[model samples]
Target: MPVDPDKARALAFPPVTVTVERGRLRMFAQVIGETDPVYVDPAAARAAGHPDLPVPPTFFFSLEMESPDPWSYLADLGVDLRRVLHGEQEFSYHAMVYAGDTVELRPRIIDVYTRKGGALEFLVKRTDIRRDDRLVAEATAVIVVRDPEVAS
Candidate 1:
C-alpha cells in the first residue's frame, strides 16, 4: 500500500538515552581512527584539563546509534525502509563530549515534504550530555531521508 503522506508527516518517535562510559569512549576513538592520547588515556585527558577520557568532535554520532530505530519511526509514517536512502547528515556541536556523562536524546520530526519523484523526511535530534543536571554539551543532528525513486 502506498504511504499516506499526511500520516507520515505527523509521526513522532520516542526518546532514547545513553550513559557514556570510559570503555565506550575508547572504543569510539579507535573506530574513528583518533590517535589522540586524550581519547584513549585518562591521565592524558586529565593533563589536558579534562576529568576523564575525551571523545572526538564527531563522537556524538555514536550516541545517536543508541536512539530508537529510526527505520521503525519511518515505518510508523507509512514509509518503506527498503526504499529509504540517507541523503545527508550534519551535526552542530556546542561542547565537547567526554566519558562518564549520561546523555539524553530527544528526537523530533522536523519536516516531511515530497518532490515530484519522492519524499524527504528531515529529523532534528537534540542530545543533552549532562552530569547531574549540569549541561555538558548540546548536539543537534539533521538527517535527511530520501526516497529511492527520486534518484532515478
Candidate 2:
C-alpha cells in the first residue's frame, strides 16, 4: 500500500516533553563542536545576557527525537521504513529556548506529495515546540518514501 495523502494529513504525533538540562546542553554543545562558552557554561551564558544555556542551532532536532517512536507511527500507517529516506529538516524560531525550560513538542503531519508518477513520495511533518503556552520554535521535516519497484 502507498501513502494516503488524506490520512497523512490527519496524522498526529504524540507530544514529547523534556526539560532542558544544563548537562545535556553542554554535551550537545561539545558533540556539535560549538566553541562558544555560552553553549556549554551557564555562567558564560549569563555573562552573554542569557538566563541559561541557550540551545545551539540544530539541537532542537535532537530534542524532537524525544518524539516517541516517530518511525513506528509511520510504520503503523503502512509506510515501509526500509524505503524511507530522510529528505530534509528545517527550523524556525519565535523565541529563545534555554536550559531548565520544560518544553512540549506537538508534532503533526502537514503535507504529502509525490513525484515520478508516485514512484517517489514525500511526507512532511512539523513539530511545534512550546513553553508555558508560548511557542519557542517550529521544526519541519521531510521524509521521502521510495517505491521499491523503481530502484535501479
Q: Encode model 1's per-residue lDDT on 1-152: one tens digit a residue.
A: 33454565466656567888899888877887889898899999999999899767766667767765745876676556665666545566556667887776655555555554555555444555554566655666544555554553
Q: Which residue runs of candidate 1 sit more than 4 Å off their true CA positions?
A: 1-9, 68-70, 119-152
Estimate TM-scores for all models: 0.74, 0.91
The 10-residue segment with the lowest total lDDT in model 1:
116-125
In model 2, how large is the Cα lDDT of residue 40? 86
- Over 11-83, each residue of candidate 2 has an lDDT whose tens digit, in order, gives 7677899888889889888887889988988898999999999987687888877655757767867988888
**lDDT scores of the candidates, listed in order:** 0.65, 0.86
Off by over 4 Å in 2: none
Against the hidden true structure, what lDDT does model 2 obtain? 0.86
What lDDT does candidate 1 reach at residue 17?
A: 73
